[model samples]
Target: MYRPLLRLLPALLVMLASASVLAEEVQVAVAANFTAPMKLIAADFEKDTGHKTVLSFGATGKFYAQITNGAPFDVFLAADTETPAKLEKEGAAVSGSSFTYATGRLVLWSAKPGVVDDKGAALLRGEFKHLAIAAPKLAPYGAAAIETMTKVGLLPSLEPKLVQGESIGQTFSMIASGNAELGFVALSQVFEDGKIKSGSAWVVPTNLHSPIRQDAVLLTRAKNNQAAVQLVAYLKTEKAKNVIRSFGYEP
Candidate 1:
């Protein structure tokens, strides 16, 4: 009986150690514009590593607030690089673990067919009574939209015509619901059939706006999670890059 007990004790201890090494599932706050690509990548990561992702999608600025207040997110995928850097500086993010994952594009879109012309000059024409845009103070895409308007000499004229939303998703909704005749939104939001979908849009010329360098960073909350490290590594892999590009983003 003593010999059997001794053998069983060693096996039990080994099993416990194995349990200890099992990685914790990671929680993520993702920018709304990145929703499509992130869904695909998360599925692949789960299949490859047996790790899990719990994601919340919305404006990057709002997520920053939750994280700063000690929300449980273990990773952040920001719509712009600035917030990630700020988080790192503030000790909320892990140093040296941040990287740009994609570059985003701006578009002028309308859900109503023929309401917008192919070239998007219709915005300057002020044909629409209301034009929706993301709030420049809360979302980087909003900043890009304002920059685009200023570059094209439309800011002064368009400023009064603009309606602001708190996030990209809300901007899209304003356009879709006809609350605003057209809106400035992320290009990915209008994608369909390997190209821009619905009504009409002008892919805002890249030179008109600051580079929309979207970034991802590990948070201090997930410092010890092997799954988070592995997932970040995977984002740089060709598999993940392909998915991002397919969603109309550039790596």
Candidate 2:
């Protein structure tokens, strides 16, 4: 028995070496709005494929600027389809490797349970002195919020009360910290288990603004990286779709 075990040790060592060689690390730039779901998905991706991920989250516009300036990201998960498309046109991303991964939903949320009503009438009521919103130029959710307010004819009157955060993450932080009584934010930020995790929110109707189509793409720098390719493929899998859905996104 000792002799047989000794003979198999060399083969087992070779197997371990091969496994280590095959595992690769991917660098991913994720949009701030998709933070929660992407964290879960990235973990699942690593566990399932034995690959590692290095994720960086930020505003989509800033990411776009960074990518153009040679950011070393292997993959990009953008808050809108336009950014990826622009990258593809500029030869900064792998052509034909882009796809919409999820459609985001916007919400009017307040940290306090009863501050916001089901129909989102709080804006009109003018009870809150300050309202937080992401910078429209930096975040798609902020643009949607602008559109919603404009369509509802509240922009002019509510302009003075608006407090702009550089990113949706910051906007959510302001509301959660009670710096702003309420704010427009990505539904994913406040939603979990098919409902709002805390506070009250009015799910903004999609018709009020353009559809927020989030896209994922393989960056040109990682064109030949196997792990990067696999990560993009993983985003399309049913397992990934389920995770996207759980965060109030339509996958």
Candidate 3:
């Protein structure tokens, strides 16, 4: 019996060693629009690979500037493909490492019921005093929102009522907190399980704005990090895609 137990101990030790060897922790900077889906994907990634992730959520433009200034994130999930492409050109990210992870949709949302409608006619009614939007210079969702309003001929008419947030997450908070009665926000912020969670929303038509192609890249700081590589690949997996879809993003 002592000999049998000794034999099993060797195998157990090897298994523990393997876990220790594979358990790498990656630091990820993610776009605010992707916050909800990323939380789910990170949990699944860790469970599936025995690795771990530390996540920071913010606007892509700010993250870009931070990475350029030597912020130590291992990976970046940006809200626009162009941002990652620019990072690669600037040598801030691993060459040839960027890929589209999801395409986002913009929505006009209100925390109060009946405050928004499918056609977005509320903007024309002038009933609302404040409208929140992410800053166009700092967030792709905000740029798209501006484009959407311009297409619908509401840009000039609605500019006076606009309130800006640093990021889409902040914009969502503004609307959710009643600081803005209605706003343009990422669909992922308000959507869950294939429907809007609590707010009244008008999913802006895709034709109204350029497609928001979100991309992820392995940062230069993580060029040789196996965990970062695994994470970027994981974002392309079916499991990750499902999570993105659950938040109403196109994966």
Which candidate should be chosen as best, given TM-score against the real structure?
2
Cα TM-score of candidate 3: 0.96
> What ranges in model 2 sit over 4 Å off?
none
Estimate, for each residue in 82-178, the C-alpha lDDT of model 1 and write its tens digit: 8999999999999988999999999888887777776777876888789899988889999999998888899999888899999998999899888
Instruction: Please give each candidate's TM-score.
Output: 0.90, 0.97, 0.96
**How well is each residue in 124-144 modelled by candidate 3, as lDDT tens digits?**
897988999999999999999
Using TM-score as the measure, name the better of candidate 1 and candidate 3.
3
Better of 1 and 3 by lDDT: 3
Q: Go through the candidates in order and give each one's C-alpha lDDT.
A: 0.89, 0.95, 0.93
Task: Please tell me which predicted candidate would have the highest lDDT against the true structure.
Answer: 2
Clashing pairs in 2: none
Alpha carbon deviation, residue 232, candidate 1 (Å): 1.1
Give the per-residue Cα lDDT of candidate 2 at 53.
98
